[model samples]
Target: MSVLDFDNLTKRYGRTTALRELTLSIPEGSVYGLLGPNGSGKTTTLGLALGVLQPSGGTVRWFGAPATAATRRRVGALLETPNFYPYLSARQNLQIAADVKQTDARSLEAALETVGLAQRQREPVSGFSLGMKQRLAIGAALLGRPEVLVLDEPTNGLDPQGIADVRALVQRLAAEGRTVIMASHLLDEIEKVCTHVAVLHQGQLRSAGPVAASLATADRVVLGLAPGTAADVLRAALSSLPFVQDVRPETDGRVSCALAIGHSPASLNQALFAQGLALAHLEMRHRRLEDQFLELIKN
Candidate 1:
């Protein structure tokens, strides 16, 4: 089931259209990433879906219905910077958040432990690292055990260790059977943690699907012939195969081509061998997510 759906959802600010006709459905139990560079409407989309900002056009639905107060309660969000009293302990901050949410403090212990702040719950927020504070903020969002989490650039300004902490925390949250919708400009972060991704550029949807499938669209199978074999012979053989496409020569004296749908590297190798051409090297060059992201937004 989709935890959230956006049907041609759009947001405009005066003369500028921040988000345009963004239609997407976030599947339940999946870690969905909104991938784009700055000013690409990632935040605008999140704001519209969370009801923090009214859409200029279209609809935002949560759990197949309009976002009501009850439905909003089922979603936990860390939209921007984490706000906490500098002098308050982590536990105290969560207490304040609970009060704001009108939720009981009964779940504080579990939330603290889940974010790995139980041991340091008593430490003053001023003494905690940025990553710790972020986790504490996430703990606050966990006050009522929401079924979905929405995080925007959860690792935006952290050191390597802090980024790692938040990444691990996100993974842990998804493992507990909750849907996590994260927005980030970092291609590596999205590629590493997201099960599915939607690429946005200039407020328009570029591509959306399972991460592997999206990247697979650009994958190529590289073929290298024996040292004595003429390169033209290899190219000629590839040109004759109906399943091969985009045949190109690599600078390293090797040939690369994309295989058609339902075809595999093993099948390609078998087909080449049947044509009396033995391959000295054959490997699948899986395209990086960064390459795919750049290509999507380049235009």
Candidate 2:
């Protein structure tokens, strides 16, 4: 089931339209990534869905119903920098958050343990690293035991270790059956952790689907024939195979071609062997997510 849905959602500020007619659904139990560069309306879309900003037109729904207090209670979000009392201990800070959230203190221990801050719960926030602090912020958001979590650039300003920590934490949360919607400009991070992604550009939806399906490209298979085999023979054989596409000559005297869906390098090898050709070299070149991301936004 969809945990959230945006129907023709639009947002504007005077003459500037921050987001335009964006219709998308976030599935339950998915680690959904909102992918875009800065000012691509990623934050604006989150704001509209959270009701922090009113939509200029369209609708935001939660669990197949309009967002209300009860529905909002099911979602926890961290949209800005994590703010904490510098002198307060980690546990104390969470207590304060619990008070604000009006959630019972019974969930405090679980939140601390979930964020891996249980051991340092008594340490001052001032002494914790930026990564620890971000985890605490997420712990605070978890105070109400919300079913959905929305994080905007959860690892925006962390060290490598910090980024890894947050990424793992997000994965754990999703594993526990909570829906997570995170916005990020880092293609690698999204590609690594997100099960699904929605790419946005200039306030418009570019693409949205499961990561494998959305970013899938025909991987090119490079082939080299025996010393006695002419390149034309190889090209001719490839051309005859209807599944082979975009046959091209590599600079290193190798031929490369893409195969249709459901076709594999093994299948290609067998097909060539059936036609009295043998390969001396065979390799599959996979496409990078960065290349795909750039292609999506370049236009």
Candidate 3:
């Protein structure tokens, strides 16, 4: 069943339109990604869906009805940078969250443990680092044991380990049958955690569907470089190749570049070899979520 539905939802600010006829459904128990560049209406969409902003032209339906208290109880969101009382300890902050969520206060410790903040629960939020604060924010969102979790740029200011932590937590949530919707500009992060993705551009949805299907729809091309050249040097040279769309350098002197004009792997290698580039690493490279995202935005 669809846990969240946005049907022709539109929002505006003065003369500026923030969302344009957005229509999508997030199925229950799936990790959905809301992907777009800055100012692409992702936050606005989340705001409207959470009943924080009223739509100007359409409706956001939760559980097949208008967003209401009952529906809100099942949905928890960490929109933008989550704010908390800096003076309060993590446990105290979560106590406040429990009150707001109308859930049992005893669940606070469990929520803290879920986000890996159990050990730091007594530490004041002010002394916590940015990553710790993010974890606490997630704990607050989990206060009610919500069936649906909505997080916007949850990894915005974290180090590698923090990012990994959040990613693991999200995966664990999805594994446990919770519906997760993440709004983020980090395409790689979305690729790693999201099973489905919605791409938005200029206040309009460009695509909405499974991540694998969207990635497969993208054109693929491979370029093989001669041996002896450093990967960086080969990447720079191949990037200058005609129709070469992107270049990702791997370990060793191996580089893969996608061609804008979709061609078979063999054809790509033939073209490169014709240009005096030797064939060492020749295989079709899979398109990353960022590649598909940029393609959507550009078109």
Best by TM-score: 1
Task: Output the lDDT of residue 292, model 3.
Answer: 75
Order of models, best lDDT first: 1, 2, 3
Is candidate 2 or 3 superior in TM-score?
2
- Backbone N/Cα/C clashes per model: 0, 0, 0
Model 3 vs. true fold: TM: 0.79
Q: Which pairs clash inside model 2?
A: none
lDDT of 1 at 13: 93
Indicate whether candidate 1 or candidate 3 has the larger lDDT: 1
Report the lDDT tens digits of candidate 1 across residue range 55-170. Answer: 99999999999997778888888887788999999989999888777788999999998778899999899998777777788788788888999998888666787688778978
Residue 94 accuracy (lDDT) in model 1? 90
Question: Tens-digit lDDT track for model 3 on 1-299?
Answer: 99999989999899999899999999999899999999999999999988788889888889889998778888888988878999999999899878878899988878898878888889899998877888788889988789999999999778888889889989999999999999998888888999999999989999999997777657454444566665665566566667666676565556665555455667666666766667666766576777778878995
Worst ten in a row by lDDT for model 3: 217-226
Stretches of candidate 1 exceeding 4 Å from the true structure = 85-89, 119-129
Give the TM-score of each candidate: 0.92, 0.88, 0.79
lDDT of 3: 0.84
lDDT of 1 at 4: 97
